[model samples]
Target: MNETQSILLASACFALAFILASLLEYWLHRLMHVSKKVGARHLEHHRNNTGQGVLWEFRDYIRGAIVLIAAMFFYSWVAGIGWLLGSLAYAAFSAYAHQLQHENPTKCFWMKMPVHYVHHKYGMWHHNFGLAVDWWDKVFGTYKLVDWLTEEELSQPEKNLLQLRWW
Candidate 1:
């Protein structure tokens, strides 16, 4: 229960929780666009007419606040402020990445932005599946190119990945 031990323990626990949450996020992303119809709830997100954007998904924002508070409370009880900070940071980063990834060209890894945009447009369910970073997608082998970004489109490197977006 020394200071160093507490810090190490907290860091480990925080990393474990973050990895689990990130993995879960990948699956959740896949589910949202699983079908072309967009399911009942996600359909709202797909509507170009409503002028809704992913960042304004109010349902998720409200739910996220509650979950974040609860997670912080639980982490604080078990491992003190360090763990709470780690978990909160992880949660906030994940949510921010999800929103930013889909939002306009705000501050983000520019290289991945177009790739993800293609995924969104073409429904590349398997590719660009990771949020917060594409590290997971690259690790998991689920990364696929937008169908149009085939051998030809990639060679040019300026055709908007063609029109297939995601394969």
Candidate 2:
């Protein structure tokens, strides 16, 4: 094909890859909950460690690094630089969001940690499943970011969510 045709094809590929990546993220995010055998550990991860304390619960950072690297290598192949950049952005955003979820932010106009705080209420395991963006949660019929606490838990001085306690 000619140079123009090649560029157009690449652009199309990028757009398609972007949409596919988004869809894949949504599916994978849900899978992390639904597939007990595969993501049971990750699911327990939330139950065990809510918020920033999660990063410390992993006994082996090497295993986590290996998983991340493999994912990056696989994604960078067909998705190209744009998607790769998005992957990086998503990782950073997820980490920040996780941090924000634990403790309220002073001014969180960007990550909106307070939006996630509601999920910290009691019996909220099935809600706010998205790690990076709320789009997937909203689409997958589990976008209840608001608090789902019992009257008893809400009445307590400190909400006692079933979360991982790193303290």
Candidate 3:
């Protein structure tokens, strides 16, 4: 292929990788809400503004590493260095954006503000499942705009959407 063709192909591959990874994250987030055991741990995440504790964080890191390595290998074979690098960038950005969205939503730039804020503040567990982007939530009819809840209200013992049977 010519150099221009190669670059276009690589760009397409990169875009595809990012879209696929985001979709996977969307589903995983939804699953965490559906399963009781998963929801319990995630509940702690909502209760504590910081994040999941060290052990769970470590587990997530391990999982991310495995996925990243596999993506690197696959994309390298399929679309050369350009796509592999793009996938790596996508993974890193997704991780950083998610952590920021949880730890301090105000500081996050790429994701829509207060979408995650509303998620945590209202325990709207099923609404905003998309981490790095809101496309899936929008596509799946789960996106909703919510005003901020008071701290006292946020602390109330409410039904988590994740704990629901049809979430």
Candidate 4:
């Protein structure tokens, strides 16, 4: 293929990779709750957010890193560099969004993320599994909009990303 054609192909693959990654995150997040072993480890993340420091969720971070590295290798082999790069982008975004969820950002942008916010708000381990988007959840009947929750109910968690401390 010519350079231009290759770039185009890679771009297409990147888009596909992003969609796949989002779907993958939804399934994996759901699995983490359903599977005993996965849920046990993931519980640490819940506990850490309750009162402990954010850094205490080191295992979650490490697991995400290992999975992303493996995914990049596999996606590159299957779809080429563009797909791999796209997967990397999804991985980074997923990490940031997850942290923001745990940090309990109050800003409109952070608060608007339906999936992660619902997951934390209700402590609903089985629902709202999407990371970057809610398409899959909506399709699968797992999406739970938090708009119904009263402001008082939402106050338990960090109100906004601005609450995050650098120290």
Tens-digit lDDT track for model 1 on 1-167? 78788778777767766676566666766677676553457556445412133434333533644465356546555454544555556566655555544443234544444444456666665677665656667777877644433453335423221122121
Q: Put down candidate 3 lDDT per residue, 15-130, tens digits, no spaces.
A: 87677767777787798889987668766777785544334443473475555536555644547455555656666556555555554555445545445556766678679876
- Tens-place lDDT per residue, model 4, 63-138, is 6655654555564453567776777777656665666555554442633554665676678776788765677888
What TM-score do all the candidates reach, one by one? 0.60, 0.52, 0.67, 0.71
- The TM-score of predicted model 4 comes to 0.71
Per-residue CA lDDT of model 2 for 1-167, tens digit only, reads 67686566546555554454445555665676678786777666567645545344222222433344245445444334444445444444455555555543322345333434554444455776654456666677877644334474345454223233342
Pairs clashing within candidate 1: 122-166, 127-144, 146-165
Task: Evaluate model 2: give its TM-score.
Answer: 0.52
Instruction: Please identify which of the two predictions, 1 or 4, would achieve the higher TM-score against the true structure.
Output: 4
Once fitted onto the true fold, the runs of candidate 3 whose alpha carbons sit more than 4 angstroms away are 37-41, 52-80, 149-167
RMSD of each: 7.5, 7.5, 8.7, 4.3
Model 1 CA deviation exceeding 4 Å by range: 35-39, 49-83, 110-116, 145-167
Error of 4 at 3 (Å): 1.8
Candidate 1 global CA lDDT score: 0.53
Clash pairs (backbone) in predicted model 3 = none
lDDT of each: 0.53, 0.50, 0.62, 0.64
